[model samples]
Target: MPRRDSPGPESWETLFTGISHLVTPAPGPQRGPAMRELTVVEDAALLVQGGLVAWVGPRRDAPRTPSTRDLGGVAVVPGLVDPHTHAVWAGDRLADFEARLAGVPYEEMLARGGGIRSTVRATAAAPMEELVQLARPRLEALARSGATTVEVKSGYGLDFEAEVRMLRAVRELQSLLSVTLLPTLLIHVPPETGRAAYVQAVCAELIPQVAGEGLAVAVDVFCEREAFTVGETRAILSAARGHDLGVKLHADQFHALGGVELACDLGALSVDHLEASGPAQIVALAASETVATVLPGVTLHLGLPAAPARALIDAGACVAVGTDLNPGSSPLFNAGLALALAVRLNGLTPAEALTAGTVNAAAALGLRDRGALAAGQRADFLALHSPDWRDLVYTLGASPVRDVFVGGERISL
Candidate 1:
C-alpha cells in the first residue's frame, strides 16, 4: 500500500522543503485587526505544479513527488505587491530636488515649467524602445527588493500619442520581465492650456483606444487642486467604466478636495496618497470597500505628514502600502523600504505592514490571484534570510529577502 502522502500520478512538478517557517495571510484582502492574523507553519513544505501552489503544510505530511528542492531553512512568505508606482519616465528631477531643498514648494514647481511637466517633455520625446529601456532597471530594482507584482502607471505622457506609447512600452516590458506588471492609464494633470479639451480627449479618444486595445487594466486620475477637479475626475472615470476599465484615484495628497468621497462613491479600486485626509475621509473609506493605499515613501521624501493610516485601519478600513516610485516627488526604488517606512511613519505594526504590502496591496490593484500562499494561487513568494517574517519590515535600509521565486522557479537577481 502506498503512503498517504503519495502523489498518485497527479504529476507534481516540484516539492519545496527545508523551510524554517512559512508565514502568510488568508487568501483574500485582510482588514482591521484581522490584518495581523497571519498563519505561521513551522517546518513547512510547499508543493508546486503547473506554476501554482498545489499544497502547503508541514514537510512530514508532504506528498511523495519525483522532484524536490531544499530551500535551506528559510522563512517563506507571499511575494510583495506594489499597487502604485510611476516607474516609467525619462529625464532626471535633480533640479526639482534642488528647488525643493531650497524651499520651493512642489505646486510652485509645477506651476513654473518644472515637476511633472519637465518629465512629461522628456518622456514624450523618448521613443517607445527608449522608454522600455529606461524603465527596465527601475522595475528590476523593485523586483530585487521583493516585489513580484508591480503596477506601472503611464502618467508622465499626458497626451494621447505619448500616453499610448507609454502603455505600449509597458507591454514591451512585460515580455522582458519576470515580475508581473499591471498597466494603468493615469490622467496626471490638466495641460497648461486646453484643460477642458484635454479632459474630453482623454474620455473620448484615449480611454476608448486604451480599453479597446486592452493596454491598461485600470484608469487612474490625479484628483487634486493642481490636477483634475472632483467633477472632471468623475467624468473621466465614468468614461473608463463605460469602456469596462477599472478605476482608481490619486486623492487627498495635498488637499482633501472631496476626492476621497468621490472615489468611494464611484467605487474606485483604491484611493492613494491620503496624506491630506482627515477624519471624514477616514469615515468614508471605512464605510466603503475601496482600499486605502498610503504611500509612506512620499512622506519620507516630501517632508509631508504621514497619511491617517492608523485612523483608517482603526476605523475598519482596509489599508495598503506602496513605493510610489517616481521621478519628481518620490525617487524611492525599494518596496521593502516602503514597508519599513509604513511601520515607522504610517503607524503600522510589522505584521500589518506586511499585510499592507502583500495581500492588501494586491487588492489595491484589483488582483485576486497572486497575493497569498494558498493552494491554487500563483507560486510567487519570497524566502527571507531570517526565520521571523517580521524582519522584512523590521530591517530598515536593507533587504531581508534571500531568494525570490515566481511560478515556483527561482529568479536570478
Candidate 2:
C-alpha cells in the first residue's frame, strides 16, 4: 500500500488547484454524442482527503487542506477506465498478424489453430509467476497512458487450471500496482477436443471454484460463429449469474448473431465488440442497461470496420471504449491512444470518447466510486500536457498523460 510517487503530502490529503479545464461528465441514464454535455469548469480546485474527492469547485471557494499541489494550468480529466482487456498471457502472435494481413480471414485462422488457440497453448504452458511477470509491463504501460482502472480477462487460459493461473496472476497484479484491475473469467473458446465436456467443466466446476475463491468479479464469453453459439453463451452466463458473478459478453465482433439480444435479456454489465452491429442492435442496446463497449483498438489492429460508436451514442445507449489488449487481436496497451482511435476511427467526438472511456467505462466494470471527479468519488484524475482535453483525442498514437493520481496517490506517468 505504498504510494506510487505521492500526489501530495504524506497523509494522502491534499488540495489540487490551477486546472485550466475540468471535464466532469454528468451522471445519467444513457451516453452518446449529444449526451457529451459534460460540465466544464475553468480554473477549478479539488480537495482530496483519504484518497477521495472531498470537495471540488472554484479555487476561491476551496477549503484549506494540509497540503496542496498546483497543476500549473494543465487540463485534468477523469482517469481512463478500460473496460475490456486480455492482459494475462504469454506468447507472440506476430505470425497470425502477418497471416491476417495476407488476406486470411480471422475465423479461418482460428480454425487452422493460429489464433487464440495458439496463444492459449503458450499461456497454458506458463507458470503463475511467469504469467504475472509478463503482464506487469502491459498494465504499467496502460497506467502510464492514463488508465486508473482496467478490466483484465482470463481467456487465454482455456482450461480450469490455466484459467486459475491467469486469474491468480491478475489478483496478484492488483496488489502490486496502484491501478485497479478487475478480473474476468472468459472461457474464451471451446477446447479443440470435446467442446461439450469442456463447457460442462467450466460451468459446473470452474465457476464454483472461481467464485468460491473470489478470484473474478465477472464472467465473459466470446459469442461468435467461430466461438460459442448463442445457446452456449446463454448457458454459461446463466451459470455465472447463479454464482452471483457479473456477466459480460464478447458479442458480434465479426458476424451478426443474437449475442446482443441475449446479453440484454440477461442484463449483462457490458456487451463488447459490436463491429457487425446494425441498426436493430443499436436500438436494442439503447433500451438496456448493458454498456455498449466498443474497442477501436481491435478494429484498427485487425483492419476491420469500426464499431457503431456514433449511432450507439446518439441512440441513448451507454457507450464505452476499451483497449482490447491481447496477443493475437488488439495488443496495444495505450488507452489514451485507443481514445484517439475512438474519435478518429469510431466517429466519437472528443467529449463523447472521453465520457465513454471514463464514467461509462466504470459503469461497465461495476465500479460506482471511481469514474468522475466529484465529491465522494475516488480522486482518480490524470493530467494532460495540453490545455484542452480534446487534445487527448486529436493527438493520435501519443501519450499526453503527464501525471496520474489514483485514490489521491500520484503514480509516475
lDDT winner:
1
lDDT of 2 at 339: 86
Question: Per-residue lDDT tens digits of candidate 1, residues 197-275?
Answer: 9999899999999999999999999999989999999999999999999999999999999999998999899999999
Give candidate 1's TM-score.
Answer: 0.96
- At residue 195, candidate 1 shows an lDDT of 94
For residues 186-280, what per-residue lDDT tens digits would candidate 2 score against the true structure? 97888768998888788899999999999999999999987899999998999999999999999999898999999899999999999999999
Every candidate's lDDT? 0.91, 0.87
- Kindly report which residue pairs in candidate 2 clash with one another: 32-313
